[model samples]
Target chain A: EAEVAQSPRYKITEKSQAVAFWCDPISGHATLYWYRQILGQGPELLVQFQDESVVDDSQLPKDRFSAERLKGVDSTLKIQPAELGDSAMYLCASSFGFNYGYTFGSGTRLTVV
Target chain B: EDKVVQSPLSLVVHEGDTVTLNCSYEVTNFRSLLWYKQEKKAPTFLFMLTSSGIEKKSGRLSSILDKKELSSILNITATQTGDSAIYLCAGATAGTALIFGKGTTLSVSS
Candidate 1:
């Protein structure tokens, strides 16, 4: 079965540093989602994309976080001047559409020191 | 706001035992309910329940949704140690986004 791909399985950075995570959805999937999972908590949506356009990002902290899916195939999420509270697991998922079967990547574990 | 609540927070079982996990939701324009298994990193999809009473099954795992009751149940039979993981329940509305519950941690010992 095809799987969503993510890079930099783990990352550690200083509080004031910048960090980025990448995700490549399964081939042919048009809907992509980025979610953050804090320890002992369920994953929360950070952003959603339909092809290359963003559809929802209501909970994303625009002040320090930005995500882009420029090509409609893959995506990138970045956090500038990271804060300690930013430490968490970033997961990428995709599906054919909003209500289709979803697939998730292993995710990137970020730690802001 | 959409909300999902899972019961019993955690469970401990021995190999060969059967276990049932519960998920209840309260959301507008309900579309579907999903169950996922999270081991260490990302959550892997297990079952998606769209209609009530029609059970979705794969091997020893089965799930059913009761639209009237607003709840769902996941059943795992002849459990093995490999079944140990965190189980998450989520509710999806008319839109694409899903509202997730905290999840239940299940540990299967030999």
Candidate 2:
């Protein structure tokens, strides 16, 4: 079965540096989601994309975080001038559509010191 | 605000014992309830319940949803050491995103 793919399963960086995470959704899946999960907590949505356009990014920090899916298949999320609080597991997921459930990637664990 | 809550944040059971995990949610427009199993990495899908009082089962795991009470339960029977993992419950709203609970951690010992 096709699965969502993510790169750089782990990352470590200094505060005030820049970092990026990448994700590839399941084949033919059109809806993508990015979420942040802190230790001992559930995942929280950071953004959502429908095809190549963004559907919702209300929880994203526009001042420092950005995400894009140019061709509607793969996506990248970037954080400039990362803060210590930005340290968390960044998860990527995709679904056939809103009506279907999601499949998630192993996630990228970011650590800022 | 939309929220999902899970009970018994942690559990410890012996092999062959049964366990029940609970999840409750409050959302504006509930669409579906889903269950997942996480074993130190990505969460794997288990079940999705969209209707009330309907139970969905898979092997040793089963889940049921109660839309009227906005609650769901995941049951694992005859558990084994492999069944030790974190169980997460998520609620999706119509035309919206998913809201996940903190999850219940299950540790099945031999």
Candidate 3:
């Protein structure tokens, strides 16, 4: 089966440093999502993208986080001045539409010291 | 706000045992309920329930949704050690992203 790809399986950065994560959704998928999972908790939505346009980002911390999918295929999420509370598992998922089941990437585990 | 809640945050069972995980939701404009299995990395899709009274099954696993009750249940029969993982339940709404529950951790020992 086709899979969503993510880079930097693990990352450890100092507080005040910048961190970035990348994701490439499965071919033909038009809806992409970014979620953050804290230890012992379920994943929470950070942002959602439809093709190249953002559909929802209400839960994203705009003050320090930004995400873009300029080509409508691959996406990038960046956090500036990472905080200790920012440590979590960042997951990327994609689907043909909201009604379809989503395929999740392996995810990037981030840790801020 | 919209939310999904799972019961018995953790469970322990032995091989050949049957286990049931519960999930309840209070999402506005609810569309569907989904279940996933998480081992170490990302969660793997298990089942999706859209209409009530329709049971979805796969091998030894099965799930049913009750819209009237605003809840769902996942049943895993003859559990194996490989079934040890965190089971997550999520609720989908017509207007927003999925709302996930804290997840139930299941440990099936030999």
Candidate 4:
């Protein structure tokens, strides 16, 4: 089974520090998504990418957060001057086609101290 | 804004019991409804329904979509402890991203 891959299964950082997470979607999957999930809440969409272009990032905090899928295959999400409230699990998902079911990665759990 | 809502945020049952999870949505250009099972790590795809009146089934799990009401239900039969986890529902729209519901946490005890 082709699975989406994520790096740094867990990360701990001091407040105001920088953190970065990486994700590689399944091959041939054109749609990639980044989501933030709190302990008891469902995953919230942070950004969506389609073939190296951002389709939606309305919920992303541009001031401190940024995500890029340069070649449209792999993506990186970075947070500068992270805050305590930023602690959560970051999940990456992808689908071969739009409007289809998504396959998710194991996720990177970030803890901002 | 597109929205998805799930019911009975938490549920607890014993083995061999039957349980039903609900999901409702209000989305623009609604395309399909999907269900996923989340354990300790990543969520696994369970089912996807794009048409109404047709039920999708896999082993002990089955799901149906009601386009007229914009809702869906996931039914689990002969549940086991392994079924304890969060079940999520997401509504996908054409030319847009998916809108996810809060999810229902099911705990099936022995």
- Which 10 successive residues of model 4 chain B have the least lDDT summed? B46-55
Docking class of 3: medium
What fnat does each of the candidate structures reach?
A: 0.78, 0.84, 0.78, 0.70
TM-score of each: 0.96, 0.97, 0.98, 0.97
Give a tens-digit lDDT track for model 4, residues B1-110. 88999998999999999999999999998888989999978889999888643489999999999988989999999999999999999988886577889899999989
- Model 2: residues with Cα > 4 Å off, grouped in runs: none
Name the best candidate (by lDDT).
Answer: 3
Residue A84 C-alpha lDDT in model 4:
98
CAPRI category for model 4: medium
Per-residue lDDT of B38-71 in model 3, one digit per residue for the tens? 9999999999888753589999999999888999
Model 3, range A17-105, lDDT digits (tens) per residue?
Answer: 99999999999998999999999999999999999999999999999999999999999999997999999999999988756878999
**Could you give candidate 2's per-residue lDDT for residues B1-110 as a string of tens digits?**
99999999999999999999999999778888999998889889999888753589999999999877989999999999999998999999885578999999999989
**Which segments of model 1 are wrong by more than 4 Å?**
none
- Lowest lDDT 10-mer window, candidate 1 chain B? B46-55
Q: Is 1 or 3 the stronger prediction by DockQ?
A: 1
Per-model root-mean-square deviation over C-alphas = 1.2, 1.1, 1.1, 1.1
Q: After superposition, how far is residue B11 of candidate 2 from its true place, in Å?
A: 0.7
Output DockQ, candidate 1.
Answer: 0.80
Chain A TM-scores, per candidate, are 0.97, 0.98, 0.98, 0.98
Best by DockQ: 2
Tens-digit per-residue lDDT, B17-59, candidate 1: 9999999999898888999999997999998888743489999
